[model samples]
Target: MNKPCFLLLCLVANGLFPVYAITPGQTEKENPMTINMSINQQTYEISLSDTAAAKAFVEQLPLTLNMEELNGNEKFADLAHSLPTRQSRPGALHAGDLMLYGHQTLVLFYETFQTSYSYTPIGKVIAPEGLKKAVGDKNIAVHFYRD
Candidate 1:
Protein backbone atom coordinates (compact mmCIF):
# COMPACT_ATOMS: atom_id res chain seq x y z
CA MET A 1 0.00 0.00 0.00
CA ASN A 2 1.03 3.56 -0.52
CA LYS A 3 2.27 5.65 2.38
CA PRO A 4 -0.93 7.68 2.69
CA CYS A 5 -3.08 4.57 2.64
CA PHE A 6 -0.87 2.86 5.16
CA LEU A 7 -1.03 5.92 7.37
CA LEU A 8 -4.80 5.92 7.19
CA LEU A 9 -4.86 2.26 8.09
CA CYS A 10 -2.64 2.93 11.04
CA LEU A 11 -4.89 5.72 12.21
CA VAL A 12 -7.96 3.50 11.91
CA ALA A 13 -6.21 0.65 13.61
CA ASN A 14 -5.40 2.89 16.52
CA GLY A 15 -8.79 4.64 16.53
CA LEU A 16 -7.05 7.93 15.82
CA PHE A 17 -9.82 9.38 13.69
CA PRO A 18 -11.89 11.92 15.57
CA VAL A 19 -14.93 10.38 17.27
CA TYR A 20 -17.23 13.20 16.26
CA ALA A 21 -20.02 12.09 13.97
CA ILE A 22 -20.66 13.69 10.61
CA THR A 23 -24.30 14.53 10.25
CA PRO A 24 -26.06 14.20 6.95
CA GLY A 25 -25.51 17.15 4.58
CA GLN A 26 -22.61 18.40 6.65
CA THR A 27 -19.54 18.48 4.49
CA GLU A 28 -17.32 20.65 6.61
CA LYS A 29 -15.44 19.03 9.45
CA GLU A 30 -15.05 20.73 12.81
CA ASN A 31 -11.79 22.61 13.28
CA PRO A 32 -11.00 23.31 16.91
CA MET A 33 -7.72 24.92 15.85
CA THR A 34 -7.57 27.98 13.70
CA ILE A 35 -5.26 30.90 13.16
CA ASN A 36 -6.11 34.44 12.18
CA MET A 37 -3.67 36.63 10.31
CA SER A 38 -4.00 40.33 9.74
CA ILE A 39 -1.92 41.37 6.75
CA ASN A 40 -2.06 44.82 5.29
CA GLN A 41 -5.02 45.55 7.56
CA GLN A 42 -7.02 42.62 6.18
CA THR A 43 -7.89 39.57 8.21
CA TYR A 44 -7.46 36.05 6.86
CA GLU A 45 -8.72 32.91 8.50
CA ILE A 46 -6.40 29.90 8.38
CA SER A 47 -7.15 26.26 9.10
CA LEU A 48 -4.19 24.62 10.76
CA SER A 49 -2.82 21.21 9.84
CA ASP A 50 -2.42 18.38 12.32
CA THR A 51 1.32 18.65 12.79
CA ALA A 52 3.67 19.18 15.68
CA ALA A 53 5.02 22.37 14.12
CA ALA A 54 1.51 23.74 13.68
CA LYS A 55 0.68 23.06 17.30
CA ALA A 56 3.83 24.77 18.50
CA PHE A 57 3.05 27.81 16.39
CA VAL A 58 -0.49 28.13 17.77
CA GLU A 59 0.85 28.07 21.30
CA GLN A 60 2.58 31.41 20.66
CA LEU A 61 -0.22 33.06 18.81
CA PRO A 62 -1.34 36.67 19.03
CA LEU A 63 1.97 37.79 17.58
CA THR A 64 2.83 40.77 15.44
CA LEU A 65 5.64 39.81 13.09
CA ASN A 66 7.50 41.87 10.57
CA MET A 67 7.49 39.52 7.58
CA GLU A 68 10.45 39.86 5.21
CA GLU A 69 10.24 39.19 1.50
CA LEU A 70 12.01 36.23 -0.13
CA ASN A 71 12.65 35.71 -3.83
CA GLY A 72 9.67 37.99 -4.56
CA ASN A 73 7.34 35.02 -4.10
CA GLU A 74 6.93 34.60 -0.35
CA LYS A 75 7.27 36.41 2.99
CA PHE A 76 9.01 34.92 5.97
CA ALA A 77 9.93 35.62 9.59
CA ASP A 78 11.90 33.82 12.25
CA LEU A 79 9.91 32.28 15.05
CA ALA A 80 10.74 32.82 18.68
CA HIS A 81 11.20 29.06 19.01
CA SER A 82 11.69 26.04 16.81
CA LEU A 83 9.24 23.20 16.23
CA PRO A 84 9.31 19.55 15.23
CA THR A 85 9.97 19.12 11.54
CA ARG A 86 10.37 16.40 8.85
CA GLN A 87 12.31 17.56 5.84
CA SER A 88 10.37 16.60 2.72
CA ARG A 89 10.19 18.83 -0.31
CA PRO A 90 6.81 19.46 -1.85
CA GLY A 91 6.38 19.04 -5.59
CA ALA A 92 4.66 22.38 -5.96
CA LEU A 93 3.58 25.26 -3.79
CA HIS A 94 0.58 27.54 -3.97
CA ALA A 95 -0.39 30.93 -2.66
CA GLY A 96 -1.49 31.19 0.99
CA ASP A 97 0.69 28.35 2.25
CA LEU A 98 1.86 28.76 5.86
CA MET A 99 4.96 26.68 6.37
CA LEU A 100 7.85 26.17 8.75
CA TYR A 101 11.27 26.04 7.18
CA GLY A 102 14.11 24.14 8.93
CA HIS A 103 12.07 24.29 12.15
CA GLN A 104 12.91 27.98 12.74
CA THR A 105 11.61 30.23 9.96
CA LEU A 106 7.92 30.77 9.32
CA VAL A 107 7.17 31.17 5.63
CA LEU A 108 3.99 32.47 4.05
CA PHE A 109 3.70 31.98 0.32
CA TYR A 110 1.66 34.58 -1.56
CA GLU A 111 2.63 33.38 -5.01
CA THR A 112 2.27 29.99 -6.65
CA PHE A 113 5.43 28.26 -7.78
CA GLN A 114 7.65 25.21 -7.53
CA THR A 115 10.45 24.63 -5.06
CA SER A 116 13.01 22.05 -4.01
CA TYR A 117 13.20 23.28 -0.44
CA SER A 118 11.81 21.10 2.31
CA TYR A 119 9.34 22.70 4.70
CA THR A 120 6.77 21.56 7.17
CA PRO A 121 3.29 22.36 5.97
CA ILE A 122 1.36 24.06 8.72
CA GLY A 123 -1.83 25.43 7.16
CA LYS A 124 -3.33 27.49 4.38
CA VAL A 125 -5.30 30.71 3.94
CA ILE A 126 -9.00 30.01 3.66
CA ALA A 127 -9.43 32.52 0.87
CA PRO A 128 -6.34 32.74 -1.29
CA GLU A 129 -7.30 35.32 -3.88
CA GLY A 130 -5.67 38.72 -3.52
CA LEU A 131 -3.19 37.36 -1.02
CA LYS A 132 -0.23 38.35 -3.18
CA LYS A 133 -1.47 41.88 -3.51
CA ALA A 134 -2.08 42.13 0.20
CA VAL A 135 1.44 40.94 0.95
CA GLY A 136 3.53 43.11 -1.29
CA ASP A 137 7.32 43.16 -1.28
CA LYS A 138 7.44 45.81 1.41
CA ASN A 139 7.84 44.59 4.95
CA ILE A 140 4.52 44.56 6.77
CA ALA A 141 3.27 43.58 10.19
CA VAL A 142 1.42 40.26 10.16
CA HIS A 143 -0.49 39.81 13.35
CA PHE A 144 -1.34 36.24 14.28
CA TYR A 145 -4.00 35.16 16.73
CA ARG A 146 -6.27 32.30 17.67
CA ASP A 147 -9.44 34.29 17.13
Candidate 2:
Protein backbone atom coordinates (compact mmCIF):
# COMPACT_ATOMS: atom_id res chain seq x y z
CA MET A 1 0.00 0.00 0.00
CA ASN A 2 1.04 3.60 -0.59
CA LYS A 3 2.18 5.77 2.34
CA PRO A 4 -0.94 8.01 2.52
CA CYS A 5 -3.33 5.11 2.07
CA PHE A 6 -1.63 3.14 4.81
CA LEU A 7 -1.93 6.05 7.22
CA LEU A 8 -5.63 6.53 6.42
CA LEU A 9 -6.33 2.86 7.05
CA CYS A 10 -4.51 3.06 10.34
CA LEU A 11 -6.66 5.98 11.49
CA VAL A 12 -9.91 4.21 10.65
CA ALA A 13 -8.77 1.01 12.27
CA ASN A 14 -8.08 2.95 15.46
CA GLY A 15 -11.59 4.52 15.26
CA LEU A 16 -10.13 8.00 14.84
CA PHE A 17 -11.47 8.32 11.32
CA PRO A 18 -14.54 6.37 10.23
CA VAL A 19 -14.80 7.03 6.53
CA TYR A 20 -17.70 4.78 5.46
CA ALA A 21 -18.82 2.76 8.42
CA ILE A 22 -22.48 1.95 7.76
CA THR A 23 -23.42 -0.35 10.59
CA PRO A 24 -25.57 -3.09 9.05
CA GLY A 25 -29.06 -1.57 8.72
CA GLN A 26 -27.92 1.90 9.72
CA THR A 27 -27.68 4.61 7.12
CA GLU A 28 -24.40 6.07 6.00
CA LYS A 29 -25.15 9.17 8.06
CA GLU A 30 -25.10 7.18 11.26
CA ASN A 31 -21.69 7.57 12.88
CA PRO A 32 -20.40 4.79 15.09
CA MET A 33 -19.66 5.36 18.78
CA THR A 34 -17.89 3.23 21.38
CA ILE A 35 -18.24 2.76 25.12
CA ASN A 36 -16.24 0.94 27.74
CA MET A 37 -17.69 -1.35 30.41
CA SER A 38 -15.68 -2.57 33.37
CA ILE A 39 -16.55 -5.51 35.58
CA ASN A 40 -14.35 -7.63 37.82
CA GLN A 41 -11.55 -5.20 36.96
CA GLN A 42 -11.92 -6.08 33.28
CA THR A 43 -12.98 -3.66 30.58
CA TYR A 44 -15.08 -4.53 27.52
CA GLU A 45 -15.75 -2.39 24.51
CA ILE A 46 -19.39 -1.73 23.61
CA SER A 47 -20.78 -0.36 20.36
CA LEU A 48 -23.50 2.19 20.86
CA SER A 49 -26.58 2.82 18.74
CA ASP A 50 -26.75 6.19 17.03
CA THR A 51 -29.73 7.88 18.63
CA ALA A 52 -30.65 10.80 20.83
CA ALA A 53 -30.90 8.58 23.85
CA ALA A 54 -27.54 7.06 23.18
CA LYS A 55 -26.08 10.50 22.74
CA ALA A 56 -27.41 11.52 26.12
CA PHE A 57 -25.95 8.43 27.68
CA VAL A 58 -22.61 9.27 26.15
CA GLU A 59 -22.73 12.75 27.58
CA GLN A 60 -22.98 11.16 31.00
CA LEU A 61 -19.85 9.19 30.44
CA PRO A 62 -17.38 7.94 33.03
CA LEU A 63 -20.20 6.83 35.29
CA THR A 64 -19.65 4.21 37.95
CA LEU A 65 -22.31 2.16 39.67
CA ASN A 66 -23.14 -1.23 41.07
CA MET A 67 -25.48 -3.01 38.67
CA GLU A 68 -27.97 -5.30 40.33
CA GLU A 69 -28.81 -8.73 38.94
CA LEU A 70 -32.25 -9.18 37.48
CA ASN A 71 -34.35 -12.16 36.34
CA GLY A 72 -31.27 -14.33 35.77
CA ASN A 73 -30.87 -12.70 32.37
CA GLU A 74 -29.93 -9.08 32.85
CA LYS A 75 -28.10 -6.49 34.97
CA PHE A 76 -29.42 -3.03 35.81
CA ALA A 77 -28.45 0.14 37.65
CA ASP A 78 -30.30 3.33 38.40
CA LEU A 79 -28.95 6.48 36.88
CA ALA A 80 -28.76 9.58 39.00
CA HIS A 81 -30.59 11.61 36.37
CA SER A 82 -33.23 10.74 33.81
CA LEU A 83 -32.29 10.08 30.20
CA PRO A 84 -34.49 11.20 27.33
CA THR A 85 -36.50 8.24 26.15
CA ARG A 86 -37.96 7.16 22.86
CA GLN A 87 -40.84 4.97 23.82
CA SER A 88 -40.73 1.61 22.05
CA ARG A 89 -41.57 -1.97 22.88
CA PRO A 90 -38.89 -4.64 22.75
CA GLY A 91 -39.87 -7.92 21.10
CA ALA A 92 -37.02 -9.93 22.54
CA LEU A 93 -34.00 -9.08 24.61
CA HIS A 94 -30.55 -10.04 23.32
CA ALA A 95 -27.16 -10.13 24.93
CA GLY A 96 -25.49 -6.71 25.15
CA ASP A 97 -28.60 -4.68 24.49
CA LEU A 98 -28.09 -1.57 26.66
CA MET A 99 -31.33 0.13 27.54
CA LEU A 100 -33.04 2.66 29.79
CA TYR A 101 -36.01 1.71 31.89
CA GLY A 102 -38.37 4.59 32.65
CA HIS A 103 -35.97 7.54 32.87
CA GLN A 104 -33.69 6.66 35.73
CA THR A 105 -32.65 3.02 35.39
CA LEU A 106 -30.15 1.61 32.93
CA VAL A 107 -30.33 -2.03 31.95
CA LEU A 108 -27.90 -4.30 30.17
CA PHE A 109 -29.33 -7.54 28.86
CA TYR A 110 -27.02 -10.52 28.84
CA GLU A 111 -29.40 -13.37 27.93
CA THR A 112 -32.24 -13.77 25.48
CA PHE A 113 -35.71 -13.44 26.91
CA GLN A 114 -39.25 -12.43 25.96
CA THR A 115 -40.35 -9.15 27.44
CA SER A 116 -43.44 -6.98 27.86
CA TYR A 117 -41.59 -3.79 28.66
CA SER A 118 -40.83 -0.67 26.68
CA TYR A 119 -37.34 0.74 27.04
CA THR A 120 -35.19 3.40 25.50
CA PRO A 121 -32.55 1.58 23.51
CA ILE A 122 -29.06 2.89 24.24
CA GLY A 123 -26.37 0.63 22.80
CA LYS A 124 -25.07 -2.93 22.25
CA VAL A 125 -21.96 -4.91 22.99
CA ILE A 126 -19.95 -5.94 19.97
CA ALA A 127 -16.97 -8.01 21.00
CA PRO A 128 -15.35 -10.56 23.29
CA GLU A 129 -17.68 -13.43 24.20
CA GLY A 130 -17.07 -13.29 27.95
CA LEU A 131 -19.54 -10.49 28.80
CA LYS A 132 -22.27 -12.84 29.99
CA LYS A 133 -19.94 -14.57 32.38
CA ALA A 134 -18.60 -11.28 33.74
CA VAL A 135 -22.06 -10.06 34.69
CA GLY A 136 -23.24 -13.26 36.35
CA ASP A 137 -26.07 -13.52 38.88
CA LYS A 138 -24.69 -11.03 41.35
CA ASN A 139 -24.35 -7.32 41.93
CA ILE A 140 -21.24 -5.90 40.36
CA ALA A 141 -19.56 -2.54 40.03
CA VAL A 142 -19.72 -1.36 36.42
CA HIS A 143 -17.57 1.49 35.21
CA PHE A 144 -18.84 3.10 32.01
CA TYR A 145 -16.87 5.52 29.89
CA ARG A 146 -16.80 6.82 26.33
CA ASP A 147 -14.13 5.03 24.36
- List CA RMSD, all candidates: 11.1, 10.7
For candidate 1, give the lDDT.
Answer: 0.86
Q: In candidate 1, what are the lDDT values of residues 83-129, reduced to their tens digit?
A: 89966799788899999999799999998899988999889998988
Which candidate leads the pack in lDDT?
Answer: 1
lDDT (Cα, tens digit) per residue for candidate 2, span 1-147: 999999989888879755675566475246477889888988888877767888888888899988999888888999988888896888898888889999889998888788889998888888747888988789989999975
Candidate 2 segments exceeding 4 Å error: 1-31
TM-score for each prediction? 0.78, 0.77
lDDT of each: 0.86, 0.85
Model 2 per-residue lDDT at 124: 84
For TM-score, the strongest prediction is 1
Note the residue pairs that clash in candidate 2. Answer: none
Error of 2 at 67 (Å): 0.6
